[model samples]
Each structure stands twice: as C-alpha cells, then as structure tokens.
Target: MLLETSIGAVIRYKSPVSSKEPEFLILKNRRGSWGFPQGHKEHGESELETLKREVREETGIQFLEIMSFIGTIRYSYMKLNGIRSHKEVKFYFATTPIRDIVISYEHASYRWVSFLSGLNFLAHRQLKSILIKGHRTGLY
Candidate 1:
C-alpha cells in the first residue's frame, strides 16, 4: 500500500486596473475537469514549496502571498498501471496581484472566475469545500 500527497493553492486575485471584485484561478486539465493548480511533492520539498512550484509550473503567475492553510482532502484511485493508490491533497489560501495566466502543458485552459463561478466549475466535492473554506479565510 502506497500513499501519495500533493499540494495546491486556491489562488485569488483582483485586477488592479479592473473592478475590485476578486476572482479565483481555476485550471482546466486535459481531461476537461476544472480545478486549482497542484502537483505531486518532490523529494525534500515542503508543502508550501511544492505548492509554489506547482503553481508556477501550471500557471505562469508567481509571487503569491500564502494566507492560510485551507485544509486537506484524501481519496483513492486506480492508476493506469492497475495499482490502487491513496492520495491526500493539502490546500492553501493564497493571493496574487497578477491577472494574466499562461497555462502549462498539464492544463488545457485557465479561467479567473468569481467565487460562485469557481465553486460551480470545480468537479470535486472536496475541492468545492476547500474553496468555501478558503472563502471563509477572508483571503479573497
């Protein structure tokens, strides 16, 4: 039995030139499911470091101020190799000033949407709950 862990951020930002309303950044993966930027942890990497690297790799935006640790979610899935793995993801509430997004090869597209919109776009119940927890943190 093997367990894997990943880290991610519920990134919030408001355009300095546009309206003051905050928007959450969501990425569309190649499978068409939408979620926040995240990736597996590397050797000797802290959760925050993994999150920052994942965000920078998945979305070109960087220099995010980590506000709070939202929470963690765990689930199990079968990989393509027919091995079952348990995965846990730790999410943080982060804010950034950059509005422009340059998606990486891991994702198909990206969107900066309102809180409600982000909740609607998220496919996983855990992720939706994470977004709501992030909202309560007042980071947005």
Candidate 2:
C-alpha cells in the first residue's frame, strides 16, 4: 500500500461577543464533503509551510495564527486505480480574527460554526476527535 501525508488546521475564532463560543471554520468541497482545509504535502516544504499555504489557498484567510500542533489522524482508503493507500494527516490548532471567508474554487461553500456544530458538519470520527482534542487543549 502507498502512504500519503497531509497537513491541515483546526482553525478557530473567538466571537467578539463574549457570551458566544469560539467558532471553527469548515469547508465544503466540490464533492460536498465538509472538512478542514488540508492537502497533500509537497516535496521540500516543511509541515508548517504546507499548513499555512493550504489554509491560505483554501480559505483566503491571510492572518492565520498557528497556535500549536494538535495531533494526527490515520486511515486507509482505496485509490481510484484500485490500490489501497494509508494516509496520515497532521492537524494544527490555529486562530484567526478575520471571519470574512473567500473560499477557493476547490470548495463549494464554507461555514463558521460552533464546536458542536462543527462535529455535526464533519462526518468522520477522526475529525470529530481532533476537534475535541483541540477544545481540551485550551491553547487558543
């Protein structure tokens, strides 16, 4: 099986209204699956570099404050060519003050949702776990 690695961010923004919970940004891809901004790593690029680039490219949010490395999620899936591949995704806990999103062509839409809403938007258990971990860290 082939192995692939990806980098992504669990980007959150605290609402200006103190009573509201911090919201996370999730993107809906052309395929209609909702997920954090992520992409395969490129040669010669550091993990942080890939994270920032992918987030910027996907969301057009330029002022990203990457707080820390959250954790990794691993899984396997069958490729289009019928080959099985294992993949690992590294997620960072990041923050952004800007909420005006200009989603890239790769995505169909985007939403800034509360933590619980994020879990509802994401179907993958791994992704939900990542969000829970990030919330527990309280780093942002």
Candidate 3:
C-alpha cells in the first residue's frame, strides 16, 4: 500500500485595467476533462509554494493571495500494477490571473470561465460545491 497527497487552489482573478469581475481559469486534463489546476506536492516545497508552482505550470498564472483553507478530500484506488493507494488533497481559496495567459500541454485545453460556468465545466460534485460557495461569498 502507498499514500499520496496534493494541494491546489480554486484560484480567481480579474484582468488588470479592466472593469469586469474576477474569472477563474480551469484546465482540461490530458483526458480532456475540465477541472481546477492541481498537481502532486513536490518534496521540499511549502504548501503555498506548491500551490503557486502547480497553478503556474498548468495555467501560467501567479497567485496573489490564499484567501481561505477549503479543507481536504481523500480517496483510494488501485495502482497500475494492482497495488493499493490512497490520496489526500487539500484545497485553498486563492486569487491570481494577473500575468498574461497561456495553456501548457499538461492539459488539452483551458478556459477563463465565469463562476457559474466553472460549475458546469467541472465534473466533480465536491469541487463544484466549493466553486458555488466561493461565488456566493463574492470572493472571486
């Protein structure tokens, strides 16, 4: 048996020099499924640092602040060789989107979607709930 863990954020921000509200950038994975930018936390990296780096690698934006801690979700599955494995993921609420944008090939595509559209884009119910709650709070 083995265990793995990751940290990421529902990062949001508005384009500078614009009057529009904040928007979130969600990535479509290699499998082309839409979701938040997240990846495994690397060794010797702080939680915030990992969050910052992972988001950058996936979406090319830098986080400005970690607004809130969104707790953790744990799940288990079998590895490729039939080994058992479990993972715990911690999410934080952060705002980014200041820099110019580009999508890395780690995902097939990306979108700067609105709060509601993000819910529609993401497939996971728990992740959707987090986005809805964040939208209601008007925190971007």
- The residue-by-residue lDDT of candidate 3 on 7-52, one tens digit each, is 8788776467567856787888888688887789899998889888
Worst ten in a row by lDDT for model 3: 13-22
Off by over 4 Å in 1: 17-19
RMSD of each: 1.5, 1.4, 2.3
The residue-level lDDT of candidate 2 at 111 comes to 96
TM-score attained by model 1: 0.94
lDDT of 2 at 21: 79
Can you write out model 2's per-residue Cα lDDT over 17-59, one digit (the tens) per residue? 8677788999999998899999989999999999989998999
Error of 2 at 134 (Å): 1.0
lDDT to native, each model: 0.89, 0.91, 0.78
The TM-scores of all predictions, comma-separated, are 0.94, 0.93, 0.83
Return whichever of 2 and 3 wins on TM-score: 2
